[model samples]
Target: MIRVAVVGAGLVASHYAAGLQRLKRAEIEPYGVPLAKFKVIKDYVEEEVVSAYDVDANKVGKPLSEVVKRQLEGVVPVPPDVPDFEVREGVLASSGAGLDKMFPVRGRDQKLPLKEAVEEIAKEFKSDNVNVVLNLISTEPAEPFGDEGKLAKALERGEVSAGQAYAFAAYLAAKDSGKPVAFINLIPTPLANDPAFVKLYEDANSLVLGDDGATGATPLTADLLEHLAERNRKVRYIVQFNIGGNTDFLALTIPERNLMKEKTKSSVVEDILGYDAPHYIKPTGYVEAIGDRKFVAMDIEWITFNGLVDELIVNMRINDSPALAGLAVDLVRLAAALLEKGVKGTFYDVNAFFMKNPGPKEARNKARIKAYYDMISALRELGVIVE
Candidate 1:
C-alpha cells in the first residue's frame, strides 16, 4: 500500500482521493491495455492519505474525506479510513508564487525548512514506504534554472515556487529512507522536465514523472494529429482552449502563471505534427458560473490530399477535475512500481500517453501507441499485480 502525501489538497486532489477509493472496488477499466496487469489493480494498489497539505483554513486541519465532500458538494465517495486521514498544514512557498488572490496561505510558524519539511511529512505515516509525493498544486510562476547548481542556490534563497519546494522535499526524504520513492506532478509546472530536478531525482535513484497530466483535449489532439499525418495531410493551424471555474483557472488569470500552462499545452504541436503548426492553445479564462465543468473549444484547419481545405471544429463541456484526477491514479501507481526496481527519472510510456508535453517527447502517434503497451509490460514485469 502507498502512503501518499498530497500537496495542495484542493479541488483536483479531492477528485483524486475520492476516485482512487472508488476504483478500489471490483470493476472493469474503461480504457487502456494489458488487461492482464490491470486485473489486480485493487489488490496491489491502495493509497492512504497519510498526510495532506493546503493553505485553506477549512482544509488544513480537517480530514481529506470530509473536505472532499464539501469541495464536490457531496458527490465524492470516500472510504472509511479516509475521513480519519488528517490534512496537515502545507507551506505555500512565496505564497505559491503570488497565487494568494485565489488560494489562502497557512501560517509560517507551522512550517519548516525544505529538508525538515520532508522529514516532518515522512514521520506522519505508519506505512513503511512514503511511496510517492503527488503535486496537485495550482499553476505557478516558474523559470527553468538550467542546472543543478543554480537551482540549488535559488532554492537556498527561498526563491523557488511552491511546487519546486515540495519536489525538493520529496527527493530528500526518499534519499533519507534509503528506499524507493516517487514524485508525480499533476500540474503544468516543470518537475520531470527540468534538468536540475531530473538530476536530483537520478542522484537519489527515485522516480519523477510529469510536467502536466493530459486528460481531455490534449491527448485527443495528439491522436488526431497522428491520423492526419499518417493520411499525409498538411496541417495549417489549430486552436484549442479550456475555460473553467475551478481554483486552477482562477490562478491562471495571472499572465506569468498562464504562460506556464500555455507552454505545456502548446508544446505538443510542433513535435507531433513534424513541423510547427500555428496554434493557440491554453487555459483561456475562468468562469465561476461554470463551476467544475469546463468548456472546451477547438478549431483545426489543414490541407488534405489533392489540395482540399478541411476544418475540424469541435466543442465540448467536460467535468475537468475528475477526468484529470483519474489519469493521476494510474501515473502514481506506475511511478511507485518503477521506483521499486530502481528505475529513476521519467518514463516516456507513462509520460507520452499521460502528459501533454512528455519529456524527450515521443510526439509521433505510432510511438505513443507503442509507449502505452510498453507501460503495461513494465508494470507487469514488476509483478505488482497478476492476471
Candidate 2:
C-alpha cells in the first residue's frame, strides 16, 4: 500500500485528487521499478485516498468529504466523489511581500504567521505520511529580489515573519525525513531554481523541479506557432493574447513579477523556432473570477516571395485546473514510482511532462514526451505502478 498525500487541496490539487481516482482503475508501476514483479499481484491495485490539506479556513480541519462538499458550493462545482481523502489543515501564513493587496485581502483573523503556519504543515505531513507536496498555492508576483537563500539562512538562524523562511523550512523537513520528497512548484518560485535551495533539496534526497505549470494556453500556442513558422516560410510577426481570471493571472498582473511570465511565454516559441521569436505572449487580464477557466488568442503573420502576407489567428479555451489535473496525477505516480525503486534526486522525464519551465529547460525533447508517456501508460496497464 503506497501512501499518497496531497499538500495543496486547492483547485488544481483537487484535480490531482480526481486524476488519482481516474488512475485508480489503471495499474501503473510506482516509479522506476519494472512492471514484471507486480504483474501477478492482483491485490495491489487499490488506490487509496490518503490525505488532502489546505490553509483555507473553510477547508482546514474539515473531513475530506466535507471539503469536497464546500468546494461544490462555489460557482464551479466539483464531483462529490472527486476527492476521496481527508482534508486537513495546511500551513496558513500571513500574506507578506505585499501579495495580499492583489486580491480581496485575507482577514487579519484568518491569517497565521510564518513559523506557526509552517510548523503546522510539517506536523501534518509527518503525521499523515504524505509522500509528495504539489504546491498549488495561489501565485504571487516573482520575488523582486532573488535572495531566497540569504533569507532562508536568516530565518533558520532567527525568526522571520515572511513565508519564504517557512517554505524553506518545509523543504528542509521533507529533505531530511528520508521520505523522498518531491517539490512540484506549479507557481513560479525560486525554491528549486535557486542554487542554495537546489543544494538543499539535492542533499536531502528530495527532487525539486518547477518554475511553471505549462498548462495549455501559453505553451500550446508557442508550440503550434513555432511548428507552423518553421515550415520554410518567411515569418514576420507573432502576437499571443491570453486572458483568464484565475489566481495565476491575477498574481502576474503585479508589474514586478511580469518578467517571469514573459520568460516562460517567450521560451516556448523560441525553443521551437530556433531563433529569437518576436512576439507578445502573456496573461492580458482577469475576467469574471471564474475559478480556473481561461481563454487564449493567438495571431501570426508570414510573408511570401511575391510580397504577399498571410495572417493566422487562433482562439483556445480550457479548464485550467483539470487540464493540469492529468499531468499532476501522472507526476505523483512518478514520484511514488521513484520512491518504490529507491531512486532519488531529479527525475528528468517526469519533470519534462509536468513542468512548463524545468530546471534544465535546454535539455528537453518535446517529441519524446509522448513516447515516454506511452511507456508509462504501458507500465500502468501491466499493473507495475501502484500508488
Candidate 3:
C-alpha cells in the first residue's frame, strides 16, 4: 500500500483526500483531472493517509479524518475512510508567524531543534511501505536551511520552515528505513529547486517533486505559449493573473508572500517562449467571498503571419484547490512508481507538467508533454502502469 503524510491538514489536503476517495470508489466526475489515461488510479486507490501534521492547536491533536471536515464546508465531500491519524506539530519559522493573526496556530508548545523536529515526525511513519510527503501549507516566503552543516547550525535557533523541516524529516526517514519515499510540494516553496535541499534529498535517496502546483492558469499559459512558439508566432506581451478567496490568499496579502507566489507563476513564461516576453503574471488580489474558486484572466498580444498585431484573451473561474488536488493524486502515485524504477531526485516529466515552477526552472509545454509520454512508457516498462 502507498502511505502518505500531509504537512498541513488544510483545505487542499482535504480536497486531495476527497479526490483519493473518489478514485477509491471509482467516482471521478468531480475532479476535472487532465490525465490522458491514468491507469494508476487503481494503484492510487490503495493509498492511505497514514500521518498528518499541523501547528493549529485544535488540529494538532485531532484525527485527520475529523479535522479535515472543516474543509468540507468549502464544498468537496470527504471520504469516510481517509483514515484518522493524530496530527503532529510541524516545525515552523518566522514565515508562519504571520498566519497566527489570522488563525490560531501554535507549533510545538516548546520549540524543538530542527533535527529533533525532523526525527520527531519521521519516527511516526518509518515502516516498509512507500511514503509520500505532501506539503499543502499556506504560501510563505522562505530561504533554504542550507547545507547539512548550515542547517544544523540554523536548527540551533529552532527556526526552520515547515517545508525544509519536513523535507529533512522525509530524507532521514527514507535513509533509516531503506524505503522509497517522496516529498510532493504543493505550495510555492523551493524544496525541489533549492540546490542544497535537492542534494540532501538525493543523498538520502528520497524523491522530491515541487515548487508550486500548476493546476489552473499557469499550466494553461505554458501550453498557449508552446502553441505560439511551435507555429513560429512572435509574442509581444502577456498579462496573466488570478484572484481568489482562500486562506492562502489572505496570507498572500503580505508582499513578501505575494512575491514568492509571483516568482513561481512567472517562472514558466520565458522558458516556453525561448525568450523573455513582457509579462505580468501573478496572484493579483484576494476576494474572500470567492473562496477557493479563483478568477483567472489572461491577455496575450503577439505578432502574427503578416506582422499583424493579434491578441488572445482568455478567462476562467476555477476551483483552484481541487484542480491541484487532482494533480497531487498523480504525483504521489508517480513518485512511488519512479522509486521502484531506481530513479531519484526531481522527476521533471511529472514536475514540468504538474508544477508551476518545476525543478531546473524551465520547460516548454510541448516538450513537457513528450517527456510525460516517455515517463508513461518507462512506467509501463517497470510494470508500474498497465492497460
* Local lDDT at 51 for model 2: 70
For every candidate, C-alpha RMSD to the true structure in Å: 3.1, 5.9, 2.5
In model 3, the clashing pairs are none
How do the residues 71-160 of candidate 3 rate in per-residue lDDT, one tens digit apiece?
686485666777687787776655675778777887652575556766767776585353888888878787754466777576566566
RMSD of 1: 3.1
Candidate 2 achieves a global lDDT of 0.56
Using TM-score as the measure, name the better of candidate 2 and candidate 3.
3
Please report how far candidate 3 places residue 14 from its true position, in Å: 0.6
lDDT of 1 by residue, 1-387 (tens): 766778888888887776666556534352332232465443324666567777777677887878887787755546554445767776666535565566566733245664455345555422436778888877787776768899878766667777887787777776777665788888877777787888788888877788787776887777777778778799999999799998888888888889888888777777777888899998898999898789999999999777999999989998888877767776666676677666786665667777776763333322355556776676667664455
- The full ranking of all candidates by lDDT, starting with the best, is 3, 1, 2
Give a tens-digit lDDT track for model 2, residues 1-387. 545555555667665554455445443333322232433222223334577655555666667766654543554434446644556654434233445464323322245655545656666666666666666665544342235456555454434332344345446567556665666666665455455555666667766666566677655564565466556556676787777776566666776556667765566555556665578877777785645678878888877567788888888787877667556555555556665555445555555555665554334424223524654664465444553
Candidate 1's C-alpha runs over 4 A off are 25-45, 77-80, 95-97, 107-128, 360-370, 377-387
What TM-score fits each model?
0.89, 0.74, 0.91
